[model samples]
Target: MTFEFTADDQLYQLAIVLVAGIIGGELVSRVHLPKVTGWICTGILLRGLEPYHASFSGLTTSAVSSFAPYMSFVLGYIAFTVGAALHFASLRNSGKRLGFLLVGEALVTPIVVMAVMYFIGGWLKPDEMTLRTSLILAAIGIAAAPGTTVLVVQETRARGILTRTLVAAVALIDMVAVGVFVFATAYLTGLGDASADWHEHWQHALVSVAIEFGAAFLVGTAAALIALGLTRTIVGPAFLGPTMVAVILGAWGAAVGFGYSGILACTFAGIMVSNIRHDTVRATGAYLHSIGGVLFAAFYTFAGMKLDFSLVLEAAALVGLYFLSRFVGKYVGAFAAMSLADVPTRVRNTLGLALLPHGGVAVGLILLVQENVHLQDIADTVTTVGLAALAINQLLGPSGTRFALTQAGEKGKDLPRLLDFLDEQHISVDVTGKNKEEVVRCLAAQLYATASRPSLPQEEFIQRVFEREQAASTCLSQGLMVPHAILDEGEAMTGILGISSEGLDLPTPDGRPVHAVLLLATPDTDRKRHLEVLAAFARTITRDLNLREQLYHARSAAHAYDVLHAEESEEFNYFIEDALTRAGAFSENKT
Candidate 1:
């Protein structure tokens, strides 16, 4: 039957997918879960409509089929963006340990999986399946999904030896597994033919995978070289961005046209663009961020549409076997590898856990294998197992990473942060007089007292600030003092004003003294952050002539800050009008 989708039907289908996908993704993200799982699960659940399956069966017809490939293209860009984030030297240090672990897992996972599958196949339907069936099933078990794993890690903002090592290890290992898969798949297709040389199988698989990667690499390399040359010819880092994205998509196209590995191509291309005698990082980062939204949206929604509940209903057995193989391969390998490398105990423990994410690499590989001729059964098995494993990984990966980080003492500890009600704030009034040192000291004391801060035991806080003032005048040309200190306080940003009716003789980074001092204080927040706040405030002060004069003529702290707020409010969005050429990105908020 011809399935013609009316505009309303198309809109309905899209709305369902998008809304369900977003809600699921947001719900998962709220609970610190991997977004990929949320998206995929949303798709699976939508496909899980036991009653509506028949109603929407025609949704998968020709018109809708086009959407899937379009989604795939977007997914390809997302994949390229991920590749672009990878630093070339990320795997440099852990090469030996990672290699040993990856090789051992790749080889052992297949063997262990084959053994289990053979037994399970015997138990389930002894006369139905053969040894080749077990091998094929086992090969799928050997593959890992690098996409969701990467997602899980990225969500945690995970850093440390273990996280970095896991990322690099999985990336390299997945690439090798593709080659392993190629040979295993070829052998399965050969199917016990006595004349079919297994060696020839390896040669063919390796050649096919390698050629795909090589052509893609060549195209990407040339594209990056061209971009670099162009960036040199034109002396701004701006155009390099658009050029880099074009290179990524162009490489993606070459990979498809030549039947090459797009991941390898894009990965190589990103590295070349970043390293090829040009500073393309900012440009590349912007390009990646710009497309992140649409790619993620499409990826999640598409994933939801592909979820087949029937396969997942049969997921119980597949999930068990897939993880069993991974456990036998990954943990055992990790423990052994770390021990061999003499890694410290705490890190070694975390490494075992950190190495468990199977993301897009595994999923994409499963799809590729699924498309392979003669090994269609194997591919089906891989996809089923992969989707199942991905579901589980998405649920567990982030939480596990969080656990490891907390255990390693790398968790962000939010300290005693006084949430200064900045929506509308005013510092207390200051009343004191001049002697330079005496007036500043009295001002500090009044602030500490009024704010209920513990008095400095030796007045060293005040003295130290004064000594810093000695290095340079804290006074600006118009008489504003920004005396800041690196105090041993908790992480917080507070504004306190010091009143000196006669003013203090304090030096500025500029070369003047004797006037108004805005004692900027921070606890544990980094110096750069404090500087950012100062710079932001500085821009405000420097922008308005009347506001600066009012601040200069300030009698009390509360009154001064009122004018400060008025000034900040008036010019808070200077960049939209003043900083740029009011383009689309800038004008999005422009008046």
Candidate 2:
């Protein structure tokens, strides 16, 4: 049956696209592949829906564009999170190394790509070749897909120096991309105008550059400051997510409306909030973390759909040259930079590969080219080559990132697991209580007494725990309760686990009495770590029946600890040995 695709049919198409993307991601992940590749692959399949039904011919195109608002939001969200990683204290020690590496890669990559493209075009396709095309293409080449790189890093749970440096570098490189593109466009415009004075043209170009960046910075900073004020004063829990989302969207919209970059503005806002609100960083991240998955799935699936295979064949030579030159340029530049900085061998080798993914930013730049009056002559050629290169990069980039992080021994170190802070000394037996408040007080007193050199005094710690419980019930389903507090100072996460034979009368979703209570204390700065540790505990108890039963019926503190760390529970513990070593090595090199 011939079907005419229209706006009304988009919701149905969206449902199908999301499901296909999920299934594709699941299947790919099962085979030890990047789930992102699966989503993209499914998107590519969805793009060819015409084969299934002739009426579906324009469905993917219209549906994808119709969801533009969502795509922009997700990109901004991803950029914000990536920017959050740039904590001042964390980057201070290795700032020199990062600076050297960024300058090397950012400066060298474009030069190599432009030179190669220029020479290759002259030899192979002189009629289509121009310095303007080469310059514009190289300007677009500077950005590695922050979304893809961040997704892979998060997916593998990689941490340590390489991961941090790669994330920070990607964020900075995109900014470099914006600057380089602006100047190239400005100068090219001046070059196109034969009667324009060089001195006057330079002044105008500088003004344009300053305004483009200045407006974005002002918008982002203003948005962050406003959000910070509201979040600090607003005591309601429900207000956090919406408040932050609205502020980010405002920054994005304001920047875009001013004829600048929304992504850059979002990045600036994230950096502002991250550096300024160290204590509330976790709360800020939690909102994004909660909604990130579905949004990412939708964004990536649409990314895959945008890949037109027809363009690859149409400009085979240009695509081949563009992809190869860009790859070689990034790798070589990164290696040279790392060598000069005397970084770890593993990181030096793998860092470039980690930065290979290309997406949204480059596509935006190419679109800019298409819209420019003077650059219109070669816009189609640039777009075709640029997009085809991006398509190839997306397919190969995630795997490269996973491999790079793995080789650097930085996988699975992003967050602490539950067992990392639990041991025999901290797990208590015969935890006694009559009611929920009593139970919380009992756990708090026990944990504080047992803690070795705690930052907070015994009474203060107990009071903090009580205040947390007062704010929100720590009770969970399956007769478990987790009470946590953020301290002003802490070297690491410290906590106590209590097992009660006689259940305490606590509020729970399942209306069961509390048999187990895990009290946690982390420094205010380590909020994300606090959340992840809580997640680990919930996941363990909810998934393992035998382990939970063993912990409840344990004979002593030792037995309880054993139950928590048994062979079955090993999967829940995420700390790996070499991750620490790599982190130390990274520091040693910096020193």
Candidate 3:
């Protein structure tokens, strides 16, 4: 039977796409590959079957192409969300380590890829070998897939220095890649014209690109302010999602109309809102993340539908070369850079492996290259090589990232239970203190006395705790306070729990007097773990009213420890199991 498509049929087409994408994501997730790989494979399968089955045609090329505008919207949204990682506080905390790594990887990746590609091209296809072609390919190689990296990090809930650095690096890499591509494109355009004034053309192209970037920045900044303003008046996902969508789409449209970068514009807007209105950005991000899985499935499926197997097969050699070169470049460059920058050994070893995924931005760059008049002669070859490399990398990159995280000891590890660090000797049910400083001093003395090897004198430790409290009140709302510090000579994390029956005058966000105080001290190296422990305490005590009451009203230290341990056991198990499943270990065991 012949299939007659109509505008109304688009809904049915969308349903099929969603279902197929979901199935594909689920299938691959079970087998230990990234869900994105499966989504793309589903699209490829549907497209390949189209010739044999006429009905399949509707769900493949034509149907997917119809959703291009929607796909672009999703891409812009993903880019914007990724930009949230560029928060100033995070950068300030990370400091020079992150900056050095970003510069090193960004420079090394393009240089290595270009050199390898140039040599390979000269040997295999001398006609296609040109400095301009090599530079364009290198520029494309500079883009690491932030979307994939972010998704995988979220999936595993990986937290550590390496993970933080990876996120920051990915964000910086894209910006660098855009800048490189702009300059490289201008240079290529000048090269294409031998008789024309090269310097004049270069100057003109650079000015035009700069104008496009400026327009994008202005549009993005305006959209961010508007979105922040809307958050004050609008509440809930029902209003919030659509409102933000309108803002993002408007920015995207403006970028397109002005011949600017929509991805850059959306990303800048995301960064602005995230830093300026953190709560609003977080709420919106949570909503986006909830719906993003389906959108991503659709996007990758569409990407797969466009895959030309014939082109992949013909360009197999070039694709293999490009893939290996890029892989080696990222690994060596990241490792060397981190080492030279005095990053921890564990981080330097595993970070490069996690930086392997390449999608979205790279594909976007290739499309940009394809549309340029000066680059049309090499567009087909470039696209073919890119698709093949992407296909391999998308399938393999996430697994490599998972392995790196697992090896770094960040994956499959939950925050330590309160009882894990607190023992009978470390708990004080009756604490006599008149103020916050006195309570903190009591806890610090208890912690220092209990430490296996007290790194600092008791008075010195108390002074440090007071200094930390002055910097920021650890007292959270709902009668809880976590006084924490890191000492230079400290080797292991130590905790002492103190409860005041009458409560102390501790400043808290909710202005509630603090009854329970957990003092944490760790070595300077375990900052990530220190934060995790603090978060675990806050998350557990704040949510469970009964548990908090039990601890607060406990007559003895033993009773309080029991209550805390019981609550921690349940929460820790759930997170640990989820982390294992995400790392693919649980599935492997079942198999």
Can you write out model 3's per-residue Cα lDDT over 474-508, one digit (the tens) per residue?
88888888887777853777778898877877668
TM-score of 1: 0.61
Q: Is candidate 2 or candidate 3 better by lDDT?
A: 2
Better of 1 and 3 by TM-score: 3
Q: What local lDDT does model 1 show for residue 26? A: 84
Candidate 3 wrongly placed segments (more than 4 Å): 1-8, 192-209, 233-238, 413-591
Best candidate according to lDDT: 2
**lDDT on C-alpha atoms for all candidate structures:** 0.57, 0.79, 0.75
For residues 147-204, could you state the per-residue lDDT of candidate 1 as single tens digits? 5545555555554455555655655565566666666666566654667687876676
Q: After superposition, how far is residue 365 of candidate 1 from its true place, in Å?
A: 3.5
Error of 1 at 334 (Å): 2.5
Runs off by more than 4 Å, candidate 2: 1-7, 51-58, 235-238, 415-591
> 35-97, model 2: which lDDT tens digit per residue?
998888777777766457436434546557887888889888877777776766445435666
Ordered by lDDT, highest first, the candidates read: 2, 3, 1
Q: Which ten residues in a row have the lowest lDDT in candidate 2?
A: 53-62
Residue pairs with backbone overlap in model 3 = none
lDDT of 2: 0.79
Q: Positional deviation of 422 in candidate 1, in angstroms?
A: 34
**Candidate 1, which segments miss by more than 4 Å at Cα?**
1-16, 50-65, 89-91, 120-130, 190-193, 234-236, 376-386, 394-591
Cα shift from native, residue 397, model 2 (Å)? 0.8
